[model samples]
Target chain A: MAEETKGFSKEEEEWIKAQRAREAERQKRLSRRGGDDKNAVNINSLMDIMVIMLVFLLKSYGDDPLKVVDEDLKVPRSTAQLEPVDATVVTVTRRAILVDDDEAVPIREGRVDPSQKGSGGQSSMRIIPLLDRLNDAVEQRRAEAQLLGEDFTPEATIIADQMTPHRLVLEVLYTATEAQLNQFRFAIIRSTTESVGGIAEATPEI
Target chain B: MARRSREEIGQPDDPDLAPFMNLVIILIPMLLLSVVFLEVAVINVTMPLGGSTTKDTDEPPDERLDLSIALAPNGFYITAAGYQRPPIEGCPTQGPTICLEDDSVDVAERFEEARRLLAAGQDADGESVMEEGLQAYNFRELYNMLSGFKEDFPDESTVRLAADPDIPFALTVRVMDVSRYRLTESSYDTNEAFWSAEFATETAEDGEEQFANLFGDPAFAVVQ
Candidate 1:
């Protein structure tokens, strides 16, 4: 019968030790090569440039969220012969009114009484609420200016639908004028003329 | 071989960049992915009025001129001879057999015709003609039209651009910019002999005096 033992000879042990030593030397050589490549490639500088580019792109993206609303209520056309100078714009449509193309305030069906339906079942336009909101926006702007100790000439530009009743358009205009925004601009379509200043101003009916 | 220096102990020649490269590769695409293109208003404006009033220009002796651009659904009408009430006579209708409740003449055609008329009025030839097709009024056409009007009516250049309420706002702004350009050239013209003398000689007191003296007042302005 052969005897079984968990022991190795001295020669076998020395051979195993030599194999381990060889592996360790190979590993050291590989590490040294990797270290030499680190300075040549300059990965940090490359990353710095990429990070700067990313930041630049982010800063330049001043996206306005207002244009994403119901495109069905797009602004109407006009050939008014005036240049639109620096002014804040408000757009009114059949379904809703947009403030600075950012917020859409829905036009609620006007009610005559708090609890009862309007007479003839026709709702009145909630113009007062719209006016109030506009006033609030103006006040907010004013407050911001006050905080900065700067005076700003506030001008409100109204872009209304052509199908809108004259009364409604007039009321909005009246509200804006009352709000002390004299420098108003009404958008219009392009004309044949290159210069806008030459076109005669539209006279007020009043 | 040189002995290992103690000062060089624990000094790594290369800094770790795997995390940073990972961040950059992800971030570069992320930032690029985040960019969005938008259309911003370069020129703002409003429209002018009295565009359809031809009676104001009826008196040739008054030297008043009227130009009207009538826009219908499929076509446009340009009547520059003198502003007369839109001739209600020849409204185009849908074909003989099939007439729809809302069917009417080509409003786009009328817009084109109006464009042609304006072009003709501005042209030295005074012949209104247009290229076939629904040409969206762009910046160039507006520039040509307004600049020509400015050159022709150096004294009083009033152009009435009447468009259907349904036209796009962006289109309107491009048109408005054309009108705005008219005043820019006037600065150079003020240095001309005729304008300088006219400015020097104007001292009218009454409305009639003002009317007589300001007969040549440049009236090109935008009204909506």
Candidate 2:
């Protein structure tokens, strides 16, 4: 009977010892790798990439336009930073030059100065007709400002077609400046979702 | 230590980056798609009137060159505030944009040359065949003439550009370009550049690379 009791104790101890060994192996692994799971993958690289890209996009924001582009006018695209503001607007297209919707001058080599009498004398820098019109606009603006008790600033914006000759465009600018409308802004067409070169990158077909 | 060990023994480790990572992932693509790469620059021009009827008060003390450019049907009539030299004039009635009497340009040839210049890229050689075209105006001559003016007055910063009502707007911008920079033969690559004395001040950081900064300040004025 004593032999039988000793045999049962030995068998039970052997089974308990096997279970303790498995538990100790698991604790050793947990100490080496902490309580974290083995299947976890590191994404430090992806996070770093995301942070860099976010900073780059923040610097590319831009301002909005003062008015919609005229249907007849086609403005040039440039990487200029200044924005257009509310003011008297001039639209110069291939067909005609309009100052604040008033037909200021005809297209082509049409003379702003009607006096074609002088040859070697050299034409005066000022265009009388255009100046008179601009002065009228300036005076009107001054009167309105006086009524509102606001400071009067003579300003006008020119939206010229990119294809128009520099001389014609300059004339409009020169004319405006002569009339005391010196402050100005040139309109440009800038858009997102469109490449500046007007061409999209080709996608590879798999 | 014994209490902490007992508390943390069986807990699974977890990182709380779900909110931050999710935010970054969403923000990056939204901003990238809406990004506008096109730069829009505004050139500020102060036109000095020949005589202001509005106010006749304090005059500017600085004697900066009041050099003015008048765009005529024929060409440019360049003058100054205090008339020191007779106004320089050019541009023939029938020539390239700014015609000199000696210049003989066929409009058709210039058009053909421009077309060929574009197609040369698609050609096998792909070399830029024509470096420059005969502009409607003599921009090369304009550059040379303006360079002479710069040499005469080193301190002058502004030039009053006045154009005719009939002239094209591009000619004004081109004249502005030629006035400010010495265009290289390869400068045809860049169509327009904005520079005033302010350009020199802004770009002075990089001392090695040289840039053309002529009369950087451009004032657009009209003939009174």
TM-score of the A-chain for all models? 0.47, 0.54
Prediction RMSDs, each to the true structure: 15.1, 13.2
What is the C-alpha local distance difference test score of each model? 0.41, 0.53
Model 2 CA lDDT for position B220: 60
TM-score per model over all chains: 0.45, 0.43
Instruction: Give me the candidate number with maximum lDDT.
Output: 2
On residues A1-206, what C-alpha lDDT tens digit does candidate 2 reach at each position?
Answer: 35534755777766556556756876787667656355556787888888888776765443433332343444544323356675677777655666667876555432333452123222444455566777887888889999999999888877776445544555566678767786877765443212222233221111
> Least lDDT summed over 10 consecutive residues: which range in candidate 2 chain B?
B124-133
Candidate 2 local lDDT, B1-224, one digit each (tens): 11333224666545578899999988888876665443444445565565322123365523445676666444456655455344234543343233432345443344344334323433212111111222433444455556666766676767777654434444455455556544343223222321111222224556665555676567764435
Per residue, candidate 1 scores C-alpha lDDT tens digits across B10-59 of 56645677887787688778767655342222222222232232334445
lDDT per residue as tens, model 1, A1-206: 01221365666566556656766775687687774333545566777788788778767654432232132332333333344544556776644565666443554321122222222322332344455666777787788779989886677666654233333443455445445554555653332231222233232111
DockQ of each: 0.11, 0.24
Q: Model 2 segments beyond 4 Å from truth?
A: A1-63, A66-71, A75-82, A96-151, A162-180, A188-206, B1-40, B51-66, B69-102, B106-141, B144-152, B162-166, B181-213, B220-224
Those runs of model 1 whose alpha carbons end farther than 4 Å from true positions after fitting are: A1-41, A62-96, A100-102, A107-130, A156-179, A184-206, B1-27, B34-39, B46-105, B108-164, B174-224
Q: What local lDDT score does residue A94 receive in model 1, on the 0 to 100 scale?
A: 47
Candidate 2 versus the native: TM-score? 0.43
